[model samples]
Target: MLTIDITGAEVLGQQGFHRDGLSLSGGLIMDAPVGRAVDLTGFRVLPGIVDVHGDGFERHLAPRRGAMKQMAEGLVAAEAELAANGITTGVLAQFVSWEGGLRGMDFADQVFGAIRDTAGGLVTDLRPQLRFETHLLDDYAGLPARIAEWGVSYVVFNDHLPHARLAEGRKPPRLVGQALKAQRNPEVHFQMLLDLHARRAEVPAALDSLCATLADMGVQMGSHDDHTAEARAAWRARGVKVSEFPETLEAAEAADAAGDVVILGAPNLVRGGSHKGNVSALDVVSMGMADAVASDYHYPSPRRAALMLARSGVLDFAAAWALVSAGPARALGLRDRGVLQAGKRADLVALDAADRVAMTVSGGRVSYLSGDIAARLVA
Candidate 1:
């Protein structure tokens, strides 16, 4: 057991911190009498960020064209980046697509193995959230088994190919460029995209089975890019309580009405636009349509996005912070984290005025401080 006091820090969304201290014991926070504490005057002490969706680790997975990095190295670098970005509990969105290339099943297996092995020792608390492409229905049967064995925290259904089918010839050149950069043959990719859409009749049955299996196993389920109220209703019926990146205002509203947690990308809020030409996150937040805002592919955006939303008057600090913190935590059913309450796990971050991470403490132990390792525990 260890005890330290963080005093004079502003606790976001709460009454200003008294000139007292926070105490940690047995890896859980305990209230103690106020005393002379380490003064953190002028700084904000927020609950550690709980990032439900981030794929920035992909940068390390495929650092360059035709180059494959080792999972251990990528995990180390990814953990460092997450800490620097103020993410304490990070759910890396590992895409196990049917693309049949570097971003496919083998890569997912390796990364998932690394995540399971390295999670306890990493600078940040790392969890694997599988981003499953529905067209990968051929592999769906085995996923529940794998998730049961591996213990994944979250699962999101990505139908990028469905949207691509909708775009077809009107597809932007940048998307094509991205495909090429990933070493995918354009014709083959286009054919597969078309084939996936043509096979839509098979999707609902496969997805229903998969969702039911995961629900029975107590795994969290999320639907991505829901475009219509009907689409949202269908997912809701399947026990998919999370709506990720709803593409239309109607979809978001419908999810809200259905008591689904609507998750938007933090990058969309920070950039003030969506990369895929969907509904803007700022608009969603202003309309009270968003429940959680994830980092998505950009690890640093959630904290900055929270501040940006506050400054833009879309939400007050408490409401904006909830999108990145407690909202996502509750969405995933994470019981012990995402808030700075007494008796909770002392997972927290110290942030400067610019919303940059200065220190990150995970599970009552300092894991990362700025650019250095604050605590090193080997698993």
Candidate 2:
């Protein structure tokens, strides 16, 4: 193992003559003297990104309409892309919905199997996170065992059932179209929603039971796209502390006030807005409402988003970088990595001027480097 030292990088937004050298030995930072001999004159070293929610692999898995890559090939490709984007640790958000289709249980099984068979062996540490739709209660029983077997670190619950308020005045045609797009038969989906509403009182109890079960099985829970303080509070009460993609500023604020880590998508920050027409992540960061950001879909967004947030004066480099690095790592309960601190794992990335990943070091090994990775994989 190489004992390398990174010299002269500023530490986490602190100013004035703050130059430190990180020593890496045996794939982890070792306690050693900052030798004056090493030369790192102009480079800025940041921790390797820990992306808590990434769905880009879904695209790669089904690259085009009616096309799908083989599971192993997709996993390899995803790992390479993640390393190329400076993401050392990534949670692949497997969307498990009740409406059976591409994003449903069968797809989840393929993904979970791929992840289980090829986790630590991959270039980047790929973890599976089931993005469970709350209405998919029937799938919950099998999930706990899979989580335990695979060592899934995160679970996010999403309820995208059309709001009762929105449904009241909507035309049937429009509702049908929306339901079909969500991969549900229009009548079945509509009936399911109505049935769900009728059993609303039991919904929370069922969700809470599932949450407790998952927690008991040692999986961290997160709530996704929470739209209200009440919704946020309900999730927090269920011991789901990580709030993923709050749909409104108020919801994000509530999560922050409750001391829950608020995760926004890096794509939102990079694009300057939300794709779902939710709260602007830049605005959220400006208001100090977001604790972390993840590459929710696009793999490159996290690094670029961090730089964008820093350059736009929304946050300093350290604080912005934390959103992609330490913040997500901490949220996932990963203490071994995510910081350039003395005892952390030597998972680091070197970026070029455009904030593109030039090289990625995972666990003290050079896993990917600029053209080298793309060259090896693409051929």
Candidate 3:
């Protein structure tokens, strides 16, 4: 297709929503109209959702909790779902954790490799995030090299070791099933967890070294589910600048004080509180500390959360919507999309007056088009 003049829609432009038509040619937004036009009357155009942290792709990759034999097809299917949700760019947050099955390092290898090879051909930009277990001391030395080899730039540190249970010399609940899924001997896996717990005291130093090396390599780093000011401070010292879903007001406040990007789950925003009963995302947003809202597990929440924020009067439409688009793009240092301006990537979502996504375009390609708007564009 040549340059398309997207007319008669309330496009969220640099200055906010306007009826001025948008044009895209050569996979980028254009200053002026140059080709055929479509009247998207009663529709709203906004920057495509940039999912900062999401792992919903796991369903596509392992619907039954087992790896799909055809990884590439799974990724393509995942892209379709993303585009349908108005996600022009999605960060597939994969785990390299002690937990077995799809989250293990070996599966991370497969997932990252597939993303690197398959994402280039897809319309929706798929980014890879490595969620590493901070207490996995054995994996520290080669982590940077492995990240580079996997072509992944974003890494989040997490400590999900169930320390209290292990310290009590108890097997964590569902231990046997988890080990079975990972194809590990249950007793051996329990021993491994115990050993990892014993080394909890060493994580700080190990993370300090590993994160420094990753920072030197320009890899974006984040700390996950922080619960205290001290914990957030510790991560900041290690060059981790993004606090992913801080679990307390103290942690979120600490991150804000240190100039770190604080990401909250969109589900929390929609539900009015964290599902895990931690800090409320709305409370954090009300305090002006949240940098972005992400689709942590459900792909639809970012859009809904932004709309909800707008309706709740915490922010105007543009500002609320930016939480899903520009804010996330900024968190990942992606400058191409998020804002609908001339010379930027023409990534946007067109929604009906009812707020249903009618069409989605990524880099000038129509990744998704449906409803009456399809006829308008075609006609």
Best by lDDT: 3
Candidate 1 per-residue lDDT, tens place, 160-202, comes to: 6645534464443455665675568777666666666777789
Residue by residue across 1-379, what tens digits does model 3's lDDT show?
Answer: 4378888888996567888888889989899887788788899999999999999999999888654888999999999999999999999999998986888988899999999999999988899999998888998888888899989999998989888899999999999999998899999999999999998888888788888899899999999999999989888988999999999999999999889999999999999887789999999998999889999999989999999999999988988999999999999998888999998898899989889888988888889988898878877
* Clash totals, every prediction: 0, 0, 0
Please report, in order, the local distance difference test score of every candidate based on alpha carbons.
0.78, 0.78, 0.91
Candidate 2 regions exceeding 4 Å error are: 7-20, 33-42, 64-66, 165-198, 371-379
lDDT of 2 by residue, 49-115 (tens): 9998999988667675347657777788888889988898988998887545557677778788888
Ten residues in sequence with the least summed lDDT for candidate 3:
1-10
Quote each prediction's TM-score.
Answer: 0.89, 0.86, 0.98
What is the alpha-carbon RMSD of candidate 1 to the true structure?
A: 3.8
Best by TM-score: 3
* Model 1 lDDT on a 0 to 1 scale: 0.78
In terms of lDDT, the poorest run of 10 residues in model 2 is: 9-18
Clashes of 3: 0
lDDT of 1 at 124: 77
